[model samples]
Target: MPHPNFILLYVDNPQQSAKFYAPLLDKQPMESSPGFVMFALDSGMMLGLWSKHTVEPAAPKIPLGGSGELAFAVADAAAVKALYAEWQQRGLQILQQPVSMDFGFTFTAVDPDGHRLRVFAPYDPAL
Candidate 1:
């Protein structure tokens, strides 16, 4: 049976959002246009960033402050930490610092267009 394969995100500025997420995402978008961009994830899922103004007026809006945070599972905690530091240096707001949690180590940051993203690495199984 065919299953869900992609997640579409509406942003005020698709180009800026694409630039901001390129480094954080596993891979840059395979396709990008003036109003949209698509990134292929390692999990076989795809993410689409589309300009809000370009979407049809009939399209449903994603509720503000909804439970739609995007979380990425990384392979290395150090890499995630470095990325968080880099983003902070680039003037992005850091919502949470890298911290050890029950499930793993994670940090949260807001993208250029205000989307919340969490980057994390699983704890060492040998710990």
Candidate 2:
């Protein structure tokens, strides 16, 4: 069976998106070109930046990946708060401040292209 792995985020400018994510992700792009950029995440996942206008064959006219959220889970609520503060200081647009929720504590931010990035830490200490 095929498994999911890569995440391709359609961006207006691959180079600019790569630059924006580099510091936040704390890794440089493993591959970059006028139309595309790729990064290797610590979890062995691949994140690709593809030009919004250039996906071949069945490419949508509008940029993709803006509607879905990219989530990061942490050890606990404190970690969630820490990341929220850090990202806020880093100037990512904050969509939601850290708050208690059924799942635990979570905060959301938006990337340059308006894609949601969410960080959460479960209330259950065992997790």
Candidate 1 vs. true structure, TM-score: 0.77
Q: lDDT scores for all predictions?
A: 0.82, 0.86
Residue 27 CA error for candidate 2 (Å)?
0.7
Over 10-120, each residue of candidate 1 has an lDDT whose tens digit, in order, gives 888888888887876747789999999999888898999988888876356656534577887888888888878877887878889999988899998777666788889
- Against the hidden true structure, what lDDT does model 1 obtain? 0.82
Off by over 4 Å in 2: 61-65, 125-127
Instruction: Give the candidate number with the greatest TM-score.
Output: 2
Candidate 2, residues 24-125: lDDT per residue as tens digits? 899999998999999999999999988877877646555444468888889988889888888988889898988998888899898888788989987776
Pairs that collide, model 1: none
Worst 10 residues of 1 by lDDT: 58-67
Backbone clashes in model 2, listed as residue pairs: none
